[model samples]
Target chain A: MRSTVREADRPWARQGAGQHEGRFALLLLLPAAVVVFGVVIWPVVRTLVVSLYDVDSAMPGSYPFVGLDNYVRVFQDDRFYTVLGHTMYFTLVSTFLELALGIAVALLLNAPLRARWLWRSIVVLPWALPTIVNGALWRWIYNGQYGALNGLLDTLGISETPTQWLGEPFLALNMVIIADVWKNTSIVVFFILAGLQTIPSDLYEAARVDGAGPWRAFWRLTIPMLAPSIAVVLILRTIEAFKVFDIIYVMTGGGPASGTQTIAFYTYLQAFSNQLFGYGAALAYLIVLAVFALAMVYLRILKQNQLAGVE
Target chain B: MKPTSPSSGSIAGIIAPRPTRRGLLVGGSALGLSGLLVACGVGGGGGKKGGGGSGSGSIRALFMQQAGYSEENIQEMTAAFMKANSGIKVTADFVSYEALHDKTVAAAPAGTYDVVLIDVIWPAEFGTKNIVADVTDRWPDDWKQQMLGGAVTTPQYDGKFYGVPWILDTKYLFYNTAQLEKAKVDAAELDTWDGVLTAARALKESGVKYPLIWSWQQAEALICDYTQLLGAFGGTFLDDAGQPAFNQGGGVAALEFMRQTIVDGLTNPASTQSLEEDVRRVFSSGQASIALNWTYMYGLANDPKESQIPGDVAVLQTPAGPVGRPGVNGSMALALTATSENQDAGWKYIEYLTSQPVQDKYALSSLPVWESSYDDPKVVETNPAVVPQAKKQLGDMILRPQVASYNAMSQVLQAEIQKALLGDKEPQQALDDAASEAAKLLES
Candidate 1:
C-alpha cells in the first residue's frame, strides 16, 4: 500500500519541478516590478490626482475637487501665454545659436589645427562647469555699472553709456541666451565632433573628386550624415530649454519686470510663490504635453530623414 | 526506464518527489513580501526611534539671512543658550530672504524646525495656520512699554502674540555728506519727494549725473519702497472693510513720483534693476548722491574698512511726502513652533536670544527691538547716527497688510508696479490692475 501511494504522487511531483522553475523566475522579477511601480508610476499618478484639486497647504485636509477648473484658470491667465511665448523665443533662439556655433567649432576641432588635442580638451571646460557658477559669472560680466562687457564696449567705442543687458526686456532675454549659448554650445560641439568622426573619409574624398569644395561637401555630405546627431541635440536642448529655471532664477529673478519669466518660472511662482499648487500642477502638465508633442515631432523628423537617407 | 506515471510505481517516483508548484509559488512570494515588509518596517522604526528618543533633547532653529544675523553670530548665540541650559543643544539653519517664507511653510508641517525667524508680516499667516504657538501671556508685565509699540503689535493675530520681535528695522534716506555739501543743498530741504527731486537737480548741476538711487528692483524691496511712499502720500492700501484701496487716494501720485524719478534721471535708469545692496554699493562708491536703503547700510557705510566714503555718510528719516514721514517695518521676530517636541527648550532658547543683554550685544549689527536698547552704551557708541533716526522712524513706520493673503497681494502689487516702472503700463492702470487682482486674492 505504501508503494502504491508513492507511485500516485510521482507524476505530480515530477511536473511540479518544471513549474517551480517558472515560479522562481517570476519571483526574481517581482522586486524590479515593485521598484518601477513605486518610483516611476506613483509620482505621475499623484501629480495627476493633485492637479484636479484645489490644494491649500495651510488647510491640508480641505482640498476641494475642482475638475478642470485649474487648467481653465491657467489658460485664462495672460501671464501663462506671455511666458510660453518667451520660453519658445528663448529655446529657438538659443538652440539655433548653439547649433550654428557648435557645428563651426566642431568642424574646426576636426581640422588639423595646431594644438588640436589641447583645443579639444579646453572646448569642453564650459560645459563641465556648474550651471550656477556660469550664471553668476555671466551676471557679473553683464552688470550695468561694473560689467566687463560694458567696459569692453566702452573701450571699443561701441556705445557711450552702459547697456542694461539684464534690465531691458528684449536685451535681457538675448543676454540670457548668449550666456546659455556660451555654456551649452560646447555640448553640441562634442556631439557633432563625435558624429563627424563616425563619417567615412572616402565619402569626403568622393565629394572632393566630384568637384565639390569644403562648403559644398559640408552641405551635401556632412550635414546629411550628421542629421541624426543634430536631431538628438535639438531634442535634448529643446526639452532642457523648455524647462529652464535656474539660470533665469539666478540671473534676473525673472525680473526687470516679468520679461524673462518662462513657463517654468511662472509655474514656480504660481505653485511656490503664490501657493497655488493646483494651478501650478495644471500648468506643469500642460508643459509636459507640450514637451511630449515636441519630442514626438523631432522623433518623426529623425525617422523620416533616416528613411529618406536609406532610400 | 520508461517515463513513469506518478500514479504507478517507477524509478522516477523515488528520484523526484517534490512539493507542488502552487505551494512553492505561494511560499516564495510570501517570503519575498515579508522581506520587503520587514525592511520597510525596520527603516520606519529606526526613523521614529531617532525622532522620539535622542532628538528630543536638541532643537533646530531656522533663520532668514540678515547682516546682523550671520551664521557666526547665530552659532555664538546658540553656544550661549546651550551653556545656560546645560543639557540642551541647539542647531541653526539659515535661508535667504526669497526662500525663507516658503521653506518655513514646507518645513513646519514636517516638524523640521523648533524655532523659526518670522517676518513681521508673517504672523497673521503663521498664527492663522497654527504653524506657530501663541504666547500672548508669556511676556513680562513691563514688556509692553519695554518694546516698541509697533514691534509689540506686529506679531499679534486675533489679540494673541505669536513671537518676540527681535530686530527693529525700517528704511532710511542715506546721503553722501560730501555730495550734499558739494551740491550746497541743506539736508532739511531734502525732506519731501519734490525736495528730493530738486536736490537731485542740484546734485546733477554739480556733476553727480545720477543724484538719487533707489532700490527699485521688482521684489519685496520694491513693494517696501512703494508702500513707504504710499504711506508718505497719505494713501492706504486696504480700506476699513478690508478691501484693496491702493489704486485710490494718493496711490497714483506715489507711483508716478517713483516713475518720474527714473524718467527725470534723478535716479539711475539702472536703478529699476538695483536691489537695496546695489543701491548701497552705488552710494558707497560715490556714484550717487542719495540712496534709499535699509538701516544696515548706515553701519556699513560708516565703517572705514567696509565703506569707500567712511567719513562722508549720513542717515536721516525716510523723507516725508504729501502727508507725513512714513517707513515700512522690516523687523524680524522669533517664533516657537507648535509641532516642536521640545517647546519648553525652544521657548527658553528664544527668551535668551531676545533678552536685553543679548540684544544689546547684537545691536551693532541688528537694531534691538527693545526701545531701551537704543540707550545701551555700546549701541549708542557704535551706531550713534542710526539710533535716533531709527527710533523716530520706528514710531512713524507703516506696516504692510498683516493678513494671510499678504504674500500673494505683495506679488501682484510688485508685478504691477514693475510693469509701471518698466514702461509696460501706466501707473494708474498698473495700480488698478493690482488692486483688482489683489482684491480677488483677498476674497479667495
Candidate 2:
C-alpha cells in the first residue's frame, strides 16, 4: 500500500515541475506583454471605443454611447473635408519636392568634391535642428515686415513692396510647405547619400563604356539600385507629412481662413479645443487609415519593382 | 506510468493514495484565479484613489500665460496661497493663452484639473456646459462691485455668474509720435475713422508702408474693431432677445468702412489676416507707424531690449466711429470647478490672488480687474502707459456677446469676415450667411 502511494506521487511531482516551469515562463513574458498592452494596445482600444460615443470632454463620464454618430459628423463637416484635402495636398507636394531635391543634393554631395565631408556635414544641419526651433526660424524668415526673405527680395529690386508670405491666405500654405521641405529634405538627402555609396562604381563604369548619358545612367542603373532606399524614404516621409501639426500650428494655427488647416490640426481642434473627444478619436482613426492606405500603395509599388527586378 | 483505470479502488486506498495530486491541482488553479482577479482590480483602485485625494490632498490649477509675468511670480503666488492655507497645496500649469483655453476644456471632463483660469468670453461657452461652478451666491457683494464694471458682467450666462474676473485687457490705438510729426498730420485729428485714414494716407504718401496697422484676422480684436465701428454707427450684434442684428444698416456701413480702408490702402492688405501679436511685431520692428493692439504690448514695446523704438510709443482710444466711441473690453476670469474638493480653499486662493494688494504687486505684469487695485498709487505708477485710458475705457467698454454658442458663432463670423475681407462675398451676404449658420448652431 505504501509503495502504491509513493508511485501515485510520481505523476504529481512531474506535474508540479511542469506547472512551475510554465509559471516561470509566464512571469518573464507577462511584464513585456503588460507594457505593450498598457502603452500601445490599450490606447488604441480606448480610442476606438471612445470614437463610438458622443464625448464632451468638459463633462467627465458624461459621454453616452452614440454608435457611429461622431464618425458620421466628422465625415459631414466641411472643415474636415477641407483639412483632409490640405493634408493630402501638403503631403504629396512636399514629399515629391523633398525626394527630388534630396536626390539632387545627394548626387552632388556623392561626387568627388574638394571638401566632401564638410559639405555633407553642413547639409545635415537643417535636419539636425529641433522642429519647433526650425518652425520659429522659418516664421521669422516669412515675416512680411522684417523677414529675411522679404528683405532679400527688397534688396534685389524684385519688388518695391514686401511680400506678405504668411498673412495672405493664398501664400501661407505654400510658405509652410517651403519651410517644411527645406528642413526635411536634408533627411532624405542623408538616406539617398547612404544608398548612393552602396552602389558599385563598376556599374557606372559599364554604363559609361556603353555610351550612356548621365541621365540615362541615373535612370537605368542608379535609380533601380536605389529603389529600396527610395521606397523607405517615401513611406517614412509620407506618414510624417500627413501628420504634420507643430510647424503649421506654430506658424499659422490653421488660419488666414483655415487655408493651412491639416487633418492633424483639425483633430487637435476637435479633441482639445472643442472637447469633442469622440469626433477627435474618429478623426485620429481616419488619419491612421490614410497613412495605412498610402503605405499599402507604396508597398505594392515596392513589391512590383521587386518582381520586375526578378524578371 | 501505470494502467490506472483497471478497477475502482477501495475507499481507504483511494483516499490515502491521492493527497499529492489533489494538493498540486488545487494550488495551481487557486494561483491562476488569483492572478486574473488582481489584474481586474487595478482600474477600480486607481479611480477610488484619485477621487479620495481630491479635497485634502494637492490640487492642480491650469493658468493662462501672462505676457510679462515670470515663473517666479507664479511661484511667489503659489507659496503665498499655500502659506496662508495650510490644508491645501496648489500646483500651477501655465500654458500659452490660446492653448490654455483648449487645455482646460479638454482636461475638465477627465478630472485632470481642479481649477482653470479662463478668458471672460470663455465662461459663456463653458458655463452652458456646466464645466464651471456657479458662484453668484458664493462671492462677497463688495468684492463683486470692486471689479471693473463690465469685466464681471462678461462671465455671466443667463443672469448667473459662473466665473470671477481676474484681469482686464482692453484695446488701445498706438501711434508713433515721430511718424505723426513726420506726416505733419495732427494727432488730435485722429479721433474718427475717416480722420485716421486721412492721416494714414498722408503718412503713406510720406513713404511709410502701412500707416494704419491693425489685425482684422480673428478673436477679440476683430470683435473690438467691429463693435467700435458698429457702435459708432449705432449697430448691435444681437437684439434684446439675443438674435442676430448684424444685418441692419449700422452693420453694413461698418463692414464697408473696413473694406474701404483696405481698398484705399490706408491699411495694408496684410492687416486683413494679421493677428494682434503679428501687428505688434510689425510695430516693434519699426515698420508700422500706427497700430491697434492690447495694453500689454506697451511694456514690451517700451522695453529697450525687445523694442527698437521704445519711448516713441503712445496710447490713445480706438478711433471713434460715426455714432459713438465703442471700445472692446476683454478680461480674463478665474473659476473654481464644481468637482473641486476644496471649494472654500479654492475661493480663498482666488480672493488672495485678486486682492487689491496682490493685484497691485502684479499690476505691471497684467491689468488688474480690481477697481481698488487700479486706484492704487503703485498700480498707477507701474503701468503708466495705458492705465488712464484703460480706466476711462472701462466705463464705455462693449463686451463681445456672451452667448452659449459664442465659440461656434465666433468661428462662423470670423470665416465670413475673412471672406468679406478677401472679396469672396459681400458684407451683407457674409453676415446673413453667418447669422443663418449661427442660428443653426444655437438651435442645435
Candidate 3:
C-alpha cells in the first residue's frame, strides 16, 4: 500500500497538478478574454473584412468584394496625400511645441516656491478640460467679427481691423495647433514633474560640486534623467496628436478650402458623411499603419536613449 | 491578534479558512450575475415587440432637435395630439440634425421609430432602402391644390409618396428696409441678381459694411446657396439620365457670378465661413443690408428679443434668375417607417401634425406647407408679409436632385464651390472638377 501511494504521488502526478493550475487560471481569465475579443478583436477583424468590399450601409447586402481596389484608389487620390500632409504637420508642430513648453513649465513647477502645489494644479486645468469644450472656446476666441483674441488685439493696438483668424488656410492650421498645445502641454508637464521627483537631489548636488552651471547641469543631468518619461510622453502625445479630430472638427470643420482637413477628418467624411463604408475602412486601416510606423520610430529613439543611459 | 504556530495552528486556520474552488465558483457566479444584470438592463425594453393597438396604441416619433421641434414644443404638440385622440399616446424623441440620418437609418430596419423626420434630400435613400412607407394612395384628391407644389413633390419617389411635407422651407431675400431706403434702392429693382448687386454697391456707399451676407460656409448650407444660384442660372445639377450636368452652360455663369460677388466686395469676404445663423446675426445687428437665409429666420429676424433691427427687417421675393426666380426647396417631411407595427397610429399622428389647424399654429415658428394655411386669419395676423413673399416665390422654387447619392453629391459641390469662393480654383475649373467628382460619386 505504501509503494502504491508513492507511485501515485510521482512527478507525473505533479505535472497533472500543474495542468490543473493552468486550467484554473484560464477559467478565471475567460470572461475578460471574451469581452476583449468581442469589443476589440472582432471589430478590427470586421473592419479588415469590410475594407475589401464596396459597401454602402444604405444599400444593404449589395456590397461586392473589390479586393484592394479601395486601397489603390486612396493611394491614387491627391486629396489623401494633402490631408496626410496636414495630419503630419499638425502632429509634429503640436508635439514639438507642447514638449518644449511643457519642459519649461515642468521645471518651473519643480522649483521650491510658495503655493507650489496650487500653481502645479492650476497648470493642469487646461489639460483637464474636454477637447470639444477646448475647441469651442478657441473657436469663439478666433471669431472674426467679435472674438476675445480680436478684442485683445484691438485693445493692444495690434491690428486695426478685426482679423479673421480661421479665414486663412495656413494661419487657421497654425491657430488650431496653438489651441492644441495650450491644452496638451500640461499633460507633458505632469509626466515630467513625476519624472523630476524620481531624480535624487544627490545627483544635482554632485553636479554642483563638479563645478557645473545650472545650464550645463540641466543639459547633462535633468534632460537625461527625464529621458524615459520624455519617451513615454512623446509616444502618448504623438499618437494622440496624430488622431486629432474633435478639436479640428469643432474649430474648422476642415474648412477654408480643406486646408485643415486631417486624415481622420477625411476618413470621417468618407464614412459617415458620404457613407462610403468600404473606402472609409481602408482609409482607417491606412491611418492605423501610419500610427504603427510612428510608434516604431519612437520606440527606436527610446531604445537608443536607454542604451545611452546604460553607457 | 492571535498567535499561532505553523505546525499545529497556522494563522490561515486561525483567522479564516483557505479559499476553495467552491468559494471561487460562488464569487465568479456573483460577478457574472451582476454583469448579466447590467447586460439584461441595457438590452431589455428595446426589443419589446411593439404592440400594434386598435387605433389607440403608443407610437414613437423622432424629430430633428431644432427651433420648432424642441422638447417643450413637442410636448405641447403631443398634449394636443393626445387630447384629440384620447386613447393614443405619442412618444416624441429628439435627435440633433447631425445624428438624425445615421440614427434613423441604423434603427429603421428594426422599426425603432414609428414616424421619422426626413430631410428634403433623404427620401430617395429612404425609398431605396425600404425604410419608409409608401403612402401614395393615402393623399386626398385635393392634396395638390391644398399643398404647395414643391411641398407636394418633395416627398415623392418613383411615383410614390414616402412622406408628408410638414416644415415648408425656402431661402428668401431678407433685406433691412431702413438700409434699402438709406441706399435709395427700390425693393422692386431688387428682383434680379444684377439689380441686387447695384443695390449692394449703393448700400456699400451708404456705409453698410456687409451689404450682402449669405450662408456661404462649406457645409450643407453652401450647397443650398449654390443650388439657388445654379437654378437661377437655369442650370440643373443632374441630367435626364441622373448624371452630373452642372458643368455645362448656365452653371459656369452661376459660379462666376458667385465669385464676382466676393471679388466686387459686395458680400462679406468672411461670408465664406458664415452659416445661416451667422448671416442672420449680421443682418440682425444692422450690419448687413441684405441677407439670404431660410424661411425660419424671418420670425427670428423680426423678434425683438433676437434682433436689434426687428422693426427694420422685411422679406422680398427671391431674385429672378435667367429662367425665373430661383429658390431651392428645403422642406423637411414627416415619414412613416416601413417596419413600424403601429402604422395606423403613426399615420394618424402625421395627419394630425400636418392637419390645417396644427400647421397654422406651426406657422408661428415655421412656414406651413399647406397653401390654405396662408389664408388662415391666425397666420395672416401672425405675419402678413411672409405669406405673400412665399406665394410670390412659389413658382420659382426648384427641387434639389432627388437621388440616393444626393448627400455625397452635395458634399462634392459644396467643397468645389467653396474652393471657387475662396479663390483656390477658378469658376469653370471648379465646376468641371465638381462635375467629375460628382459623377464618380453618383456612379459609385
TM-scores, all models, native as reference: 0.88, 0.85, 0.87
Q: Order the candidates by TM-score, highest first — what do you get?
A: 1, 3, 2
Candidate 3, pairs of clashing residues: none
- In model 1, residue pairs whose N, Cα or C atoms come closer than 3 Å (at least 3 residues apart or on different chains), thus clashing, are A7-B6, A8-B7, A11-B6
Q: Candidate 3, residues B321-399: lDDT per residue as tens digits?
A: 7777778887888988877888788888999888888778767567788887777788877778887887777656788
What CA RMSD would you report for each candidate? 9.0, 9.9, 8.0
Error of 3 at B236 (Å): 2.0
lDDT of 3 by residue, A1-311 (tens): 35346745665676468789989998998999779766866566666767877766533354676889999999998889999999999999999999999999999999998999899889999999999999999998998867899999999999878878988778899999999999999999999999999999999999899999999988888887888899889999999999999999888878877779999999988877666778998999998999889988997987676556535
| Listed models, DockQ each | 0.19, 0.19, 0.15
Please give me the DockQ of candidate 3 compared with the native complex. 0.15
What is candidate 2's local distance difference test score? 0.77
Q: The CA-based lDDT of model 1 is what? A: 0.82
State the lDDT of candidate 1 residue by residue for A231-306, as single tens digits. 8998999899999998988788888777888999888887776667778778889989999999899889976775
Worst ten-residue run, lDDT, model 3 chain B?
A: B41-50
Candidate with the greatest TM-score versus the true structure: 1
DockQ of 2: 0.19
